[model samples]
Target: MRAHHLAAAVLVAALWGFNFVAIDVGLDSLPPLLFVALRFVLAALPVAVLAPVYGPPAPWRYIAAIGLSMGFLQFGVLFVGMDVGVPGGLASLVLQTQAFFTAIFGFLVFGERPRPRQIAGMAVAFTGIALLGLDLESIAATALGLTLVVAAAAGWAVSNLLMKAARPRNTLHLMCWISLIAPVPLLALSAAVDGPAAMATALRGVTLETLGILVYVALFTTLVGFGIWAYLLRVYTAATVAPFSLLVPVFGMSFSALLLDEPFTALKLAAAVLVIVGLALNIGLVPGRIVPQRSART
Candidate 1:
């Protein structure tokens, strides 16, 4: 990759990494489900104006499924996990487990055999997650939070399979369409779970900071990040652009420690090393046969 392209890839990773902090900030003001509903609502706005430029890449059913799985299920569970007890940095690391889940699903669904390294990588990464579970000193991290985040990772893995099957030509267009599909169900769920009164209150009491966080996540993180990512994928091979995503957790943990005062225990540091090493192995950075590589999504 060229210097500028490398910078752009790193920029996307930074935006996505800081997004966990943004979500953690937003959750202080709004309920989790409601925050997600509002996010999708704002994110879908571009689809209305840019409908001519970015057409739907798949059938409505496929788009809807992607929306529900990727947009709603993954994010909904993620926000709730963060809101409940998961620290932003820890959540980011745990979410990388999605790659392993994706590999597992690929094997089961498409009969794509996992290489030996992939299996070993999965073992190493899950061991890191197990270590994370044992770390009791990490601030605000809980068993329920860890489980929900892992489930969210599985949801993300499901969306990856759906994306592969759909074979969308334009990722940004598909993202926009899915943005449209996610808000309705999210809003309904917000009303159901968060309560209609809380939803009303949250909207009525929205602060500038909260709105800024929403805009950052919707416009910068989701749209701009993916837009640049799609461009990089077009210009370079997936293998070339994909590895930079491993930097996300690096940024995530650093930002959380600096901004959110999230302390990294010895166990947490060891776990981070294991997970990143496993991810490196899984993505073919450490050698072995390369399979169909998937780009990391936030």
Candidate 2:
């Protein structure tokens, strides 16, 4: 990869990392489900406005599947997990488990076998999760928040498989169309789960800070970040693009500590190291003879 492209990849990672903080702040004002709904509503706007210029990137079914899994399930669970108490930094690290989940789902759904190193990587990463679970500092970093974040990772894994299957030429276009499919269902779910009164109350209470958070997540984090990511993926090999994502958790932890005043406990630091090492191994970043027959895109 060229220097500028590498910079672009890192920039995306930074944006996505800081996104957790944005979501954390947004959750203070809006219920998780409702916040997700509004984010998607704004995210889908480009698709609606640009319909005449750039139509759907794939079949509606594929777009819908990606939408439900990626936009709805993943963010829905993630925001709820963070809202419940999981710190933004921890959520970022935990979400990296999606790589392992993607490998598992790929094996089951598409008969893609994970190499020995990949299997070993999963074990190491799960050990980090176990360590994370043992931290009894509060409920936020323990069972409930951890489990929900892990579940969101699974949803993200499912979306990865769906996107791989779809094989759209333009990832940004596909994403925009996927955004279009999420809002209505998410709104319905928000109403059912959070109740209409809560939604109304939250909407009535939206401040400029809340609006800025929404714009950041919807425009910068979702759209601009992914737009650059898609460009990088096109220019470089997935291997090159994939490792930069590892920087996300590093940035997440740092930004959370600085911006949100979240502590970096000893256990959290240890877990972060283990998870990042596992991810490196999983992606073949750790040099070794054991190589997979095929590279799995997380």
Name the top lDDT candidate. 1
Badly placed stretches (over 4 Å) of model 1 are 287-298
lDDT of each: 0.88, 0.87
Per-residue lDDT tens digits for candidate 2, residues 52-153, read: 987788888899999988767699989888887699989999999999999999999999999999999999999988898886484246577778999999
Write out the backbone clash pairs for model 1: none
What lDDT score is found at residue 219 in candidate 2?
Answer: 92
Regions of candidate 2 where Cα sits further than 4 Å from its true position: 138-140, 287-298
Q: Compose the digit string of candidate 1's lDDT tens values, residues 1-298.
A: 5688779999999998999889888999999988988888888898887678757878888999999997676999999988888999989889998999999999999999999999999999999999888865564598888899999999999999999999987888788889998888888998889889989998999999999999999999999998999998887778878888899999998899899999888888999999999999898884455543334542
Per-structure clash totals for the candidates: 0, 0
Can you give the TM-score per candidate against the true fold?
0.94, 0.94
